[model samples]
Target: MGTRKTKAPPPAALGRAGTEKDLPDHFKNYRHVWVFIELERGEVHPVSFELLGEGRRLADQLGVQLAGVVLGPPGDSTRRAVAEAFAYDADLVYLVEKPLLTDYRNESFTKALTDLVNTYKPEILLLGATTLGRDLAGSVATTLLTGLTADCTGLDVDADGSLAATRPTFGGSLLCTIYTLNCRPQMATVRPRVMRMPQRSNKPIGRVIRHDLRMLEDEIVTKVVGFLSDGQSENANLAYADVVVAGGLGLGAADNLQLLKNLAQTIGGDYGCSRPLVQKGWMAADRQIGQTGKTIRPKLYIAAGISGAVQHRVGVEGADLIVAINTDPNAPIFDFANIGVVADAVSFLPALTEVFIRRLAPGNHIRLVN
Candidate 1:
């Protein structure tokens, strides 16, 4: 999500100054909250459901319906996506099916989504901040001439029924809440794993409103010639990993990162680093963890030699168990970590690694503590 040049109001005052009664006559007609279900390559992205979970809450608070908007070619994948949206608690879904939408093209998707918005007039619209979402969201918002808050970490409805979108700003040093006070269908995009997944219920599929794409194939400028997969199987899968072990500048040298790798390997988990390690060229960009990088929700996160800044905090706070190993007793990581160990990470990691190796050795017959 790209930053906006407009100055945002401080968090304390967001949504307090405006009421829906103050909206223009046309804007007042906007009602439900809609999440764009990202269907790509015959599958729906999980972030779409995550947004639906959040949309459910905002809809209930405003006494409005929560809906999912799906754009794709008509088939089992599209059908399954609609059902999954209902399972994720969407009250209804707006589906636009066409051959041109078989693969995502910016021109086709932007037109289909904008047409739906203009016709249905939802009060709030959300999309995942993925590659496709970011591309389409900018066009849709620009065409509608509305305000969009990108990469929002929090979503809420104020007493006045305005959308309160909170995101990190000033280089992740602070968070601010923005309200699209004057626009209809307040737009926001959230990254994957930023919101908790909603519980799925085995409900029969709910209402589905079908719409047509009015444009012809010749009207679109871009064409999907072919798709080549990146095929990087060894690429970091930190976002969905159950266990993550990461290092920071505290390790003192790039070579010491192998200590973290050894520990992660012994425990059967992925390894990563803080943003500084990436800047220092010690780790690849994809392995960086923080607001600018990946947001993780691991079951167990072990951080070594890192001072937890606000940027890094937002990424890993969702971890079920956070263990911090830093030499400084007052490192910011200690504030939220479940366990804090003040020691040289280079030395401590190898010792901890050996203990795990021994405990899990063949015929050890010892169950590790949960």
Candidate 2:
């Protein structure tokens, strides 16, 4: 168990350099939009298909092809990933399978993807903002001397065929669109669940272009020694929960948070809190909700006393129905919440919990939202 090494800040990473010049002749041939299909443990992350859907839209808009770049061990894993990529709208799949790529090692993966990009150039590259994706994307983007926007909320192609990557900026108070005008392959990393998963099709896979893993084992510095799986904990599964009830700083005290938990349990929902509570030791870090926290897409979300700042808003905006309860009428939560209750959450929560508990006990058919 050794401490993981991190990349030191390089000079080029400090500022925008060589970004003004137009695309060179050698780079002008870059075509199509490509997504890095992240494969691990014989399964692909859903974010890969999510990106394929997005890349398909961009490719269609740019009048180019949508391709999935799969880098993994040579076997059924890679083949299955390619077929699934096609079902998810990828017009093509680029497979670079090798023994060294069986498990994710930064050195081998960077070289594999970079080699594919150098030989078969693509106009745009998309990756999920997962731990592995962020690590691989940074190394690949830097190696290619291109710009990459991380955790983009939106991705689109401009009229000129350049990538328009939009993400939250200024402490999540505003969203800004970024463009890699001079870069040959514009790159962006999207957080999971930020974009809706597209409908999978039974259509046949378009084409698979296989490439060789040219690097030797001796050239790689990092290696995956073993894998360790953590046991499941009792924390809320906020990311994919159908119903979530969360509280913010306005709950007044740590003890009062129990009211939210009781309500959430009564309604068969999980409970979480805003980031401030985590800092105050009132809630665990996993229970925090905001841009820096989990991006959730629950069917019903109840926020108690949480003022919806841009950071928190970005995380939970995908909820089908957001019920916000706060004393302040002008709270930012009111701007987007479908239901607003201008009442003291301290009293409101307990009363609502009692009502739901009573209704749930007998043969009463009831809608939980009052």
Candidate 3:
């Protein structure tokens, strides 16, 4: 005789009329928050860890887990990235490894990430605001048809358990906090150094799960041709710089930017320009300082002829101490500036440069040319 199979009992109120024990699908099950771990040239970018730190906080608030998504070529580096993610307080890590992913193309990353999100829904997604990050985030958000907030200055978990992303609006004159409403995964992009770096632990514990892209050569359209990086001599390295001197339209004309450079030379600092200067073609896009431009965290930030617009405020707010020079005493910069000098940038800049040059050895520094 065959062994008798036992039947299991059904749910308690399965056959009851007007039963109230069943919870709605939306309230029953949901996963966790995830960060897109960014790696460049086989190296992990710091911003990825920053996002992980932030994701950890959000996950804690939502009573869920924090996960990191890393895509790269299979090797020790990939494993290392997963381990580091754990150290950054990630509860779980999902990784995709393939040769086609060895280089970052908008197509490969977007496809890999979207596929993962569809399979395992996450409440939030975060990425750094680097050139490559910006490229990928925009495409991914569009592909998923989800609302994305870019250049967010603030992120938090609301009491109702939603991502509150704050960003500058109306040319940085005001701030706006955006909510995704019904979007599955609320997305946002933050600059490289906007958030504080997380502390790493010696014993980081997390689970790692490997994922297969299931994509073939024929599936991928774009090929990695080549990559060009800045030379050591020509690199801006703005975020790491100890001191920076930036000028704005208050300098008056293209010619006046030269004065700003001269001041930077005397102070032994890197030189940069504001958005207006870039708009006027007085400088390249790399030199612009504002919300839409570079987010520099220099030890000392000196601004000349700048009226301190909100957009510009976001860029340089990372400075340890900000010194603003403008003719208008009511300039917005004065509100947050550590020190304020109300004077014409053209005259004040040159005078400040002269004082710095006199204080230092004549030939010890490289003079910034106009």
Tell me the lDDT of candidate 2. 0.87
Ranking by TM-score: 1, 2, 3
Assess the local accuracy of residue 350 in candidate 1 as a C-alpha lDDT between 0 and 100: 95
Measured against the true structure, the TM-scores of the candidates, in listed sequence, are 0.91, 0.86, 0.83
User: Candidate 3 on 46-82: residue-level lDDT in tens?
Assistant: 8898888888888998999999999998887877888
Candidate 1, residue 260: Cα displacement in angstroms equals: 2.4
* Winner of 1 and 3 under lDDT: 1
- Per residue, candidate 2 scores C-alpha lDDT tens digits across 239-294 of 76889999998899999999999999999898898888899999988777878887
Compare candidates 2 and 3 on TM-score and give the better one: 2
Candidate 3: regions farther than 4 A off = 1-28, 253-259, 262-268, 357-370
RMSD (Å) per prediction: 2.8, 5.3, 11.8
Per-residue CA lDDT of model 1 for 1-370, tens digit only, reads: 4555445664544445543237888888999999999999999998998999999999999999999999999799999999999999999999998988999999999999999999999999999998899999999999999989999999999878889899988657788888887788899999888899889888779899999899999999998899987466665778878899999999999999999999999998999999999999999988888898888898899999999988888889889999999999999999989999999998999999999899988867356653
Overall local distance difference test of candidate 1 = 0.90
lDDT of each: 0.90, 0.87, 0.82
Quote the positional error of residue 319 for candidate 3 in Å. 2.2
